[model samples]
Target: MQLEDMTLEELKRLRKDVEKAIETYEARQLSEARAKLEAQAKELGYSLETIAGVSKTGSAKRLPKYRHPDNPTLTWTGRGRKPKWFIDALESGYEKKYLEI
Candidate 1:
């Protein structure tokens, strides 16, 4: 049926369905991306479990200090919130350089 001929309620329902499909697609894409990242890390001599650094009891593993991009004067250990460096870099953006899995 033509969209113009559909009732408002029907249109809303269609929109909801489309949004749900998009959400599902996005979730699947994210899962794939994470799996790929894990695989790449493994190939680079890092285990996924170690990357996430979870203990036997499921506690977070220790993270090393990293430099902040926004404020070079500052450094972070990756334990707390997104460091200024990451936030700034993300805001500035860079080309998607994905490692092959």
Candidate 2:
């Protein structure tokens, strides 16, 4: 533990180990706190997700950017790969604007 006895490499490695330990401790603390809160919420007839205002769905819902002309139920947020219907419309010479909701 003496600074004078430790080499530069040894000090660097020790720092890395200490940082990893701190990170692990912090993560465990956070998990424990979340579990405690969830247990309390459940006892009160509420879910942790509801109390935290977090959605079961991804972080948050993204509004649909496009809708099917014939079947309005079909929709997409233009995030990932296009859906089959959307590709079909494009292949049928329909412009992307026509799919906008």
Cα-lDDT of candidate 1: 0.54
Provide the TM-score for each candidate, comma-separated: 0.35, 0.43
Worst 10 residues of 1 by lDDT: 92-101
lDDT of 1 at 47: 75
Evaluate all candidate structures by whole-model CA lDDT and list the values in order. Answer: 0.54, 0.71
For model 2, how does the per-residue alpha-carbon lDDT over 42-95 read when each residue is reduced to its tens digit? Answer: 999999778777676876876566766556678888999999998987785556
lDDT of 1 by residue, 8-56 (tens): 9999989866654543453345447667988999899987667776553
What shift in Å separates residue 78 of candidate 1 from its native position after superposition?
25
Report the poorest 10 consecutive residues by lDDT, candidate 2.
22-31
Clashing pairs in 1: 53-61, 69-85
